[model samples]
Target: MAKYKTLIFILEGSLLNEKVAEQNALRQTLKLTGREYGPTERIQYKSLQEKTKLLGFDERIKLTLQEFFKNDWISAKGAFDNQLQKQDQLNKDVLPFLDEVKNKVNLILLTKEKKDVASYRMQNTELINYFSAVYFKDDFACKFPNKKVLTTILQQQNLTPATCLVIGTNLVDEIQGAENANLDSLWLAPKKVKMPISPRPTLHLNKLSDLLFYLELS
Candidate 1:
């Protein structure tokens, strides 16, 4: 029998190369503001990124522009919005991995993105077909790391915490969210990112394809 009755997947970073998209958008934003991306900016951006995890997407962009361009931040924010809307691509291994596990367990896509954005991205990438259900921030009326989001999902799906696994790339959002909900979690750790010592995920893997082996589907 399958170990998990349901697998909750985070849309960004887990299935999509959202970090690449964000980096591309950041570079485009910098270019629009007549600045270049250098080591200093990279370091600063990473620091800011970590600090702004709880903020909404627009707020993060606004803060990023303000940090880089004090006088021209407003215009840069608009540019960043346009740049971000054009970004979003699935990780190369996503389709094959999803195919392998689609029948083994229920696949649920959960994202903090609003319905319009999430639907557009999934439609563009043809990812909606793989998921049995997709839940967005709009549906929950709250962003993740809130235990209620997971609990609600569990209640709606008639699942127990022990029988479901939350898979995500972000520690604060996915892993912590799962922990808060008292559910098992699998972290698809981002490259060069350090794993936290406390509140760690139940399992950690380097890539989406690695899940096949961990899940005994290989």
Candidate 2:
């Protein structure tokens, strides 16, 4: 039998190359404003985004754009959104990994993205067919790292925390959320970054394909 009855995946960085998408979006936004940004600016922008993550998506985008541009921030935000949609792509390992375990456990996508954006990205990547269900930010009515969202998902899916595994790339959101909910979590750290002592995930993987070995052993 499979170790977990359900595998809840974080859609953005887990399945999709969100870093690439975000970088591309930022580049497009800069182009729209006729501005040039280097690694330093990108790092600062990312830090700012992290600090403002609690805000709604639109608000966060607006605030981030305002920090860099004096005017036409709305147009920059629109350009970023449009470019993000076009730039979002599935990780190379996503297809092969999912194919190996899709039949073993129920696949659920839990995303902080709004329904429309999440749906568009999933459909664009041809990932919509693989997941049994998708829970959008709209469904939860709150940002991530909230235990309530996980508990709500468990109740709706008729699952216990022990029977489910949360997989995500973001430590603060996905791993911490699972920890708060008392669920097992697998951290997909592509760069093999050292995990912190607090809010540690149950498992740490260097790549998405490693999950197949874990599932087999479990």
Candidate 3:
């Protein structure tokens, strides 16, 4: 039998691929603002975005564009929309694993993306069918690495720490959040992804298909 009754999957980088930058948002911002910005300015803009993450991804991006680029709602909104559709590629290997374990495990989507964006991507990829429930970033006031979000989910599901597991691509905050919640976690780190020295999760897997072993699916 599988060890956990509930499996919570982080949606952004965990299932879908990373965002591919087609048009430079930075340049777009500068052009829209009619300002000259060099590498240093670009670096500063990105740093600010990372720092103000508590405001949420889309919100932060929108604010950054408004503050730096000024009065270009159309361009700023376009840049945001581009990112929503960027990582549409699926980890094909996960399909078969989901097929085998779908009936046995309670699937849940715990994502950092906004609800509308998450729904759009999952629906486009036809991945929404796998999850019984989805909790988005907007759903929680406190973000990941804070135990409150996971604690709330656990309470809602009436599930204990021992019976739940989080499978995510991030080794830093994701794993730390799971541990903080006292729940087991599985880190999905591909060879191409450079991981920092961080707290390890219950399992470190290179491929999503590796979950089949834990599922005991043949």
Candidate 4:
């Protein structure tokens, strides 16, 4: 008998396309605001969206209305969250890898999103079926960087500490969480910046495709 080889891939960050969309939006906001307002923050966009909703300017005039009211962090965060929710589905490029490695990999979405919201988004993206298990924030009553949360998941699934991997964008959270759980960790650093401090990952990957290579060579 062989021990179960569980290769879990954790997904984070809103769709890459949405990030581009955000940049375009920020440029538009600068033009509308008549002055570039620092870096575009999600919280600001979300708050603006919320204010737009409360004002009831109608969708047709929302942009003009936003220009008049000025942008704020809360409004931006609200807008960003709303848009992000729609785009927060599974990544397309990752599908090919998941399909190729289905036999060996057990993809799990360990996210901070609540179960209902995360499930709906995953289902909409048509990516829910690929995962062996789904872990949500409510399931643990705690977020990443919490060792007890990962430990509980492993304990429930009877997983060996050494056979698991936690992958995510935020270095401190995902890498630290995996380390605290006593599991192998993969840090996806797209920006290619050196980690600020200690608690480094078992592996550093610049792209999702790199994960396949790392697993193959490791």
Candidate 5:
């Protein structure tokens, strides 16, 4: 057994680098409805990215086009779900890396991905059996910082927060979330990101498997 009993992973770029579920959802929704209000320029998208209120793909869709496209929301939302089903690329490293600790640790997958979309990704990537639990964006009342989701898991699983680790590819806000929940954090920043970084990670990794080296197995 490893020293830690639980490991919570943020799935976006950590478990899988592809965010096709997000971008594709937006693209597919746009294509289905012929809405061109979506910012095409990188600057515009980047500007919107910083707006926390418009952070969610579904929220962005509903709010931005709510006026003219109000009637077709169900279909537009369906398009988002449809594209998620076809999302390509699973981090090939995920299964092998997870295999190292699955038996000794309570493997939990946490994501901003909604429940259905997350399930679709897990099933399609053959990752359904690897996780003991999965957390969706809609699963919690609020996002990480405002919600101690990790702590919630710790209590539910009868685990200790000090013995848990939250791993993420982008820790800008997630580190704070983990800390607020009283859990340690491990981050993988392959390269420099243009955005300002905050709440430093407890550990940094060059590769996913490197996480195993830090774990104390018994």
Candidate 6:
């Protein structure tokens, strides 16, 4: 067994290289919809969520939409599920690297995905081999930044926070969740978002290419 019991990796969606992702999503969505909605006109994942409160859509459909963005789906049943494109290049970083390191890691994917939608997306992308487990909010009683959910994972995995590292793009939620769980944290700010000086990540990185180097893992 390695010194670390398991290397639990959490990937934040939207994009690792966020700008290209936004552009790609907008371009693809517009092309698919055949509507000239400017990229800026589309609301963000959070905003579209709030939109459900006003516009009347079926509750089930709205819930699916909310889950769709985080999971990075093109569409469900050929209907546009989300106007978001995952950065194609981010996958390039993982496939080659994960293939090499997977034996040394017990990979688990934690995301805000609802239901098993992300699992479906991962299968479509053929990326399911990269993870041992795929967890979504519906499986747990709570969501991120809520210690109860982290506690659930900890208990289920028989893991201590000291032996784990939480990796993600968002600082306030992801990193803070790790901190609250007493785990080491990695903030992947590939877009160069300004991280505050206080409560900084144990490791801060600009690219997934630099991940192995920063972690000092084989």
Q: How high is each candidate's TM-score?
A: 0.83, 0.81, 0.69, 0.68, 0.68, 0.66
Ranking by TM-score: 1, 2, 3, 5, 4, 6
User: Which is better, 1 or 2, measured by TM-score?
Assistant: 1
**CA lDDT of 191 in candidate 6?**
46
RMSD of each: 3.3, 3.8, 5.8, 9.1, 5.1, 7.7
For residues 143-207, could you state the per-residue lDDT of candidate 4 as single tens digits?
Answer: 76778878998888888777677766555566777788888777665544665455777777766
lDDT (CA) for every model shown?
0.80, 0.79, 0.72, 0.59, 0.67, 0.57
Residue 18 in model 1: lDDT: 73
Compared to the true structure, candidate 3 yields what TM-score? 0.69
Q: What is the alpha-carbon lDDT for the whole of candidate 6? A: 0.57
List, residue by residue over 75-133, the lDDT tens digit for candidate 1. 77777767776777888899888888887878998987788877776777868888888
Candidate 5 clashing pairs?
none
Any idea how many clashes model 4 has? 19
Which regions of candidate 2 deviate over 4 angstroms? 37-78
Order of quality (lDDT): 1, 2, 3, 5, 4, 6
**Would you give me the overall lDDT of model 2?**
0.79
lDDT of 5 by residue, 188-207 (tens): 66534332355667776757
Give candidate 2's error at residue 116 in angstroms.
0.9
Worst 10 residues of 3 by lDDT: 18-27
